[model samples]
Target: MNTEVPRLSVVVPVFNEQDVLPLFVERIRPVLDELGLTYEVVAVDDGSRDATPVVLGLLRRRWPQLRVVRLRRNSGHQSALAAGLRRARGQYLVSIDVDLQDPPEVIGDMLRLAQREGLDVVHGVRADRSSDSVFKRWTASLYYRLIQRMAGAAIPRHAGDFRLLSRTAVDALVALPEHLPVYRLLVPWLGLPSGEITYTRAPRAAGRSKYPVAKMIRLALDSIVGFSAAPLRVATWLGLIGIGICAVLAGAGVTAHLSGTTVPGWTSLLVALLFLGALQLLCLGLLGEYVARIFTSLQGRPAYVVAFDSATDAEPAEDALCRL
Candidate 1:
């Protein structure tokens, strides 16, 4: 095991990315090597069912800087990233996806900016995303805008997880008590000295996108619920609106009865009942989401479990720091 801490750590959270692993390495290695910095690439395998683990094992033999951490089960991307961040032994840390859509070459720029400007965080913002599907681009735009409004943070508009963090920023993130953290929001909320570099996002080198519509929606929910109480406030507003409607209906009912023109229509009553019921249910559902997260946090369950860590000499102990 290498006891020496590297100057930089590149943490890549991957799941079933067998086809793109080689290409990712091919592109990223040269950038790191050219920068002439001591670095380690920590690739967290989020319980891949394909050849990802095998490929990583083979790559480790060739690239000594490559360290593989396999989760015991299929943890989500953020969980896998958290595991890597905890295990990283570097002065500077970076989180990027294995898809290669965010250019690997830009890593050098991030490092340089972090050093030259003395910034704690350097964000790799996307200048152009012309390669993405129409739906993806649209939803991503809406997601970023919505999160900024709800979270009350000026998170970079087009920045994903591709960014550099200084040692102080890394330690601060690791110490956060959040069970389900949205790094995009959490990092900006840190109020660290930050800078941004724009890059044109390229198409994936190979394989399909791991983040489908369902996962995207899940991530958005986590971000919204984890950082802000705007959902609860929205629910309050909805309840008020529902009450106003009911009051108006009651006034109409009383006026019609007093005027002696009471047309007994089941259809109007049924529509009003259904609409109010649906609105009530929607508000309850939103509240339920926050309550469920609180319940999970109170249970004290680990966010992720590591099945194996290639960087360690012995098996991870029961109380390992990476347990969460």
Candidate 2:
């Protein structure tokens, strides 16, 4: 790590954010400059179906320090972030969303904490999130609690991709091989000394949020199952409990029959059958998740394939280095 390099690489993953890019870049550049730090802005185009790429090209034309990386297909947010991390060339790396809800000015606070506190990672936490609707906020809170319970990680409630990482932390994260790594979970797995800077998340400036409720729910499920075995264990307990319930019911029915108090059993049997069937489906789904992850790992598939490289990076070509 070059401590004196004095360069901060700010990576923003864009997916159809053309309308907001201009404002994001304008607000961010000035804040970056105010930190007295040399920086490069990397905009990862995650196969935007809009005019995002054209707008990114316009920015690159205006500023030499602005760089754009274009992916051939829409790899999800995690993949886009992985690509940006691979291309980042700086002593410190800051990754955030293009929506700008995290605020650009917080970068200075993160940098100060990193340097003064000697922390390897600095995650920005939302001190108060009154801007979000009640349902959204409640779901967000529930998602974090569920992940913490299942993953047993200290991932903060409101932290997203808006964080600063030291050179070592960046390298460590990129070295990880999980195809669907939830960075929110991996940060704690790496066990780096870290601190947080509190800030209020701002509302979207334009172009609706990329993540709707469905996407948010899916992401939350992926994070919990990807990082921990608790889901499978819960499935096991559910299956066992279901069996126990059926056994007790059977015993009760047999006892009633022996006592000559037998009643028509169709309704009771039908209800038990339906309940057990649903339980079986839940268990199967959980098992399938683990099996799928293991099967993919055993198949030795690469996490991502670089369709093309527009910029040179320090590491060897990913194709040359990929062991999986």
Best by lDDT: 1
User: Per model, how many backbone clashes are there?
Assistant: 0, 0
Best by TM-score: 1
Which stretch of 10 consecutive residues in model 2 shows the poorest summed lDDT? 315-324
Regions more than 4 Å wrong, model 2: 1-6, 307-310, 313-324
Residue-by-residue lDDT tens digits, candidate 2, 39-60: 8877888888998876776776
Write one digit per residue (lDDT tens) for candidate 1, span 4-23: 98999999999999999999
Give model 1's TM-score versus the native structure. Answer: 0.96
Residue range with the least summed lDDT across 10 consecutive positions in model 1: 315-324
Give the Å shift of residue 248 in candidate 1. 0.7
* lDDT for 126 (candidate 2): 89
Give each model a TM-score: 0.96, 0.92
